[model samples]
Target: MNHVAPPGWPEQVRPPDAPEWERTAVGWLLDQCPPEYRGHTVLRRHPVALARLTAWHVEACQAGARRGLAEARTALRDALPMDAVEATIAALLTEQARLEGVRRAAGLVEVALRGRRFPARLPGLGSRHE
Candidate 1:
C-alpha cells in the first residue's frame, strides 16, 4: 500500500535508507563543520550543543502539531474557541518559520570557518566533505 502525507506536511520525510549518523542532527552538524576546525575542541563540541537545541526545537514543533490537531478536532465537535485555535495555529506557524533558520545556523560555523558567506539559500550543504 502507498503511504500518503498529510496536508502541510514537509515534502520530504526522513529517508529510510540513510545511515544512523546521517539521520541525526548532531551528525549533520559535525559533517558541516569545516575540515580545519574539526580538530579543535570547541568545534568538535559544537555538534553536541546543536543536537540538544535541535531536540528541543523538534519537541516544541511536535507539541504544537498535537495541540493544533486536538483543537481542530474539538472544533468539529463543538463551537470552536477561536483564541485557543489561533494560539495553536500560531505555534505551528512559528515552528515552520524557524526551521530554515535552524538549518542556516547549523551551517554557519562551517561557512565562517571557511571564510565563505552562508548563502541565503543553502547550496552544496550535503556535498561538502573534507
Candidate 2:
C-alpha cells in the first residue's frame, strides 16, 4: 500500500512508505538547518536526529521573529519612519507565520521518524503533531 502523509507534512519529504523516504526527509530537514549541519554524518545517517535538529532550528527562528516583532516599533522609532517601522513589523509577522508552518511540518516529520502512523481518514484531527 502507498503511504498516507499526515496533515502538515512537508511537501519536500516523500511519504514514509516510499523507497528512500528517509533520504528525502534528511534532505528537507538538513535544508532547514545551518550549513554546518550537513557536515555531520550522524544527522545524515539518522532521520530522527535530523528531524530533531531541524525542529530546534525552526523553533529558534520562530523565537527570533517573535522578538523582532515585539521590538520593531520601539527599536526603529528614532532611526526609521513610522511607515518603515510598520513595514518591518509586517515583515516579522510574515516570518512568524512561515516559521509556524515550518515548525508544524518538522514536528510531523519527527513523529513519523519515531514510528508514529496516521490513518487515512482522521476526522476532526488537528494538525498538531503528537
Candidate 3:
C-alpha cells in the first residue's frame, strides 16, 4: 500500500513501512538530542520538563569543556532513575554545539593529510618512484 503520512503532513514525512515499535524507538532516540536538534522534550508541563531534563543530565551543567563531558551526558541517559526516556531535541543546532566534533575533526585531519604536498613519494608508492 502507498504510504500515507500523518494528517496535514508533508510527503517527505511519510513513514517508510515502519512498524509502530520502530517508530516509537526512533521517537525515543530523537528525543535525546538537544533542544534545537530535536525540539523541546518535556512539552506537556513544567514539572515533566524539569524531571526529564534532569534525567538527561547527570550534573546539570552546560556543555563540558571537552569531549569528556559527553560521558556525563551519556551517564544521565544510561543511568535513568527508572529507565524512562524523555528529553528535548536541542542538542546540535547552535554554532557552539558539537555532539561529534572529535570525529569531524579527525575527518578534517585526514583530508589535510590527503591534500599535503609531499616532496618525495615513497619507494613503492607514487609519482616520485623511479
Candidate 4:
C-alpha cells in the first residue's frame, strides 16, 4: 500500500510534537489514512473517539512492526469498543484487503486473456524430430 505522510505530522509518533487536541490528532490521522477514510465525518464530530483511535493506531503500528501482525491485530481487538478512529482504520484495512483481492482477480484475468491470444510453446508435446 502507498504510504504518504500527512502534512504537519511530527517526524516521529511520540514526544515534542504530539498534538494536545483530539481534533488535531484526527486530522493528522486522516491525512495518513487511505483516500476512502480520509473524508469520514464521524471522526470530525467525535474528538474523544478520534484521540483513542489515533493512540491505538500509533501503538499498534509500533507493536506490529516490533512483534507481529497477528499480535497487532489481537491487541487492537482486545481494546474493544474502539474509538471512531480505530473502527475506521479497521474498516479501511478490510476495504484495502477487498480491493487487493479484486486487483489480483483482474490480473489473473489479464494473464488468461494473454495466454489465450498467444499460447505458450510446449517443449516436448509436439516434437518435430522425435
Candidate 5:
C-alpha cells in the first residue's frame, strides 16, 4: 500500500491552539525576546545568551501562580514579565495579543509575506506578561 502524508501530522504532535503548547524554555524565550533574537544563531552561537535565556525561562515557570503547568504555560504570554513576539508569523503562529502589535504583524506579513524585522515589539504593548 502507498503511504500518503497525513494532514495535521506535526500539529497532532503539538497542536498550535492548545495554549502553552509552545511554552517550554526555548518557546518562552521565543515568545518574550525580540524576533531578531529567535534564531539558532543566538542560542547556538553564544553560550551566555543561551544560559540567560534558559535562566529566564526557569524563572518564569517556577514563580508559582497556582495555575497548573499547562495553564501557566498557556498563559505565559498573557501576563509574561517580558515582552512578546512582534513578528507576524510568530504572532499568528503563536497567537499574540495587543491589537496594535497584531495590526503591525499583519502588515508585516503582507509586505514580506515572510520577511525579516516586523516590529518584534511595539512601544505601547507593555505590562501584559507580568
Candidate 6:
C-alpha cells in the first residue's frame, strides 16, 4: 500500500512504509548532524537513535542561532562595517528559520522511526497516527 507522509516530513526521506525507508531516514538524519556523528556505529545501525541525536543536534543549532541573532549587532558593529553587521544579522535570521524547519522535520522523522505512521488524513480532519 502507498503511504503519504504528513506535513513537516523531510522531502529527502521516503514514507515510513516504503522499502528501505529506514535507511533513507538514517541517511537524512546523519546529513543533519555533524560529521563526527557518522562515527557512531549504534546510531548508524539504529534509525530511532540517529533521529534522537539529530533532534538534539538541531536543537543546539537553533539555540546557537538565537544567541547569534541576539548578539550580532553589539558583537559585530564595533569590529565590522555597518553593512557587514547588518548582513550578519540577516544571515542569523535566515539560519534561525532554516533551523526551525529542520527541527520540525527531524521530530517527524523521529516519530516515524518509533513505529508511528502518518497516513494521509482527510481534509479538515487534522492529524492522526497509526
lDDT of 1 by residue, 1-130 (tens): 1222222222222221233322343445544333454456653456445444444554565565666656664653355577766776676677656655555444443333233422222344432211
Flag regions of model 6 displaced more than 4 Å: 122-130
Clashing pairs in model 6?
Answer: none
Residue 87 C-alpha lDDT in model 4: 66
- The best candidate by TM-score is 6
Candidate lDDT (C-alpha), each: 0.44, 0.85, 0.33, 0.42, 0.35, 0.86
Query: Which 10 residues in a row give candidate 4 its minimum summed lDDT?
Result: 1-10
TM-score of each: 0.31, 0.89, 0.18, 0.31, 0.22, 0.91
lDDT by residue (4-117, candidate 5, tens digit) is 112212221122223432233234334444466666775634434543654454344333222232354455555564344223224443433332343332232223212222
Report clashes for each candidate as comma-separated counts.
Answer: 0, 0, 10, 0, 6, 0
In candidate 2, what are the lDDT values of residues 39-118, reduced to their tens digit?
99988888898899898899999999989988888889999999999989999998899899999989988998999877
How well is each residue in 24-93 modelled by candidate 4, as lDDT tens digits? 4445545444457656687667644544454455445444444533354566665655574476566666
TM-score of candidate 2 on Cα atoms, chains taken together = 0.89
TM-score of 6: 0.91
Lowest lDDT sum, 10 consecutive residues, model 1, at 1-10
lDDT of 6 by residue, 25-130 (tens): 9999999999999899999888888899899999999999999988888988889999999998898899989999999999999998898977678865653332
Clashing pairs in 2: none
* Pairs that collide, model 1: none
Q: What is the lDDT of residue 59 in candidate 5?
A: 41
Q: How accurate is candidate 4 locally (lDDT)?
A: 0.42
* Candidate 2: C-alpha lDDT: 0.85
lDDT comparing candidate 1 with the true structure:
0.44
lDDT rank, highest first? Answer: 6, 2, 1, 4, 5, 3
**Which portions of model 4 show Cα errors greater than 4 Å?**
1-25, 32-36, 68-130
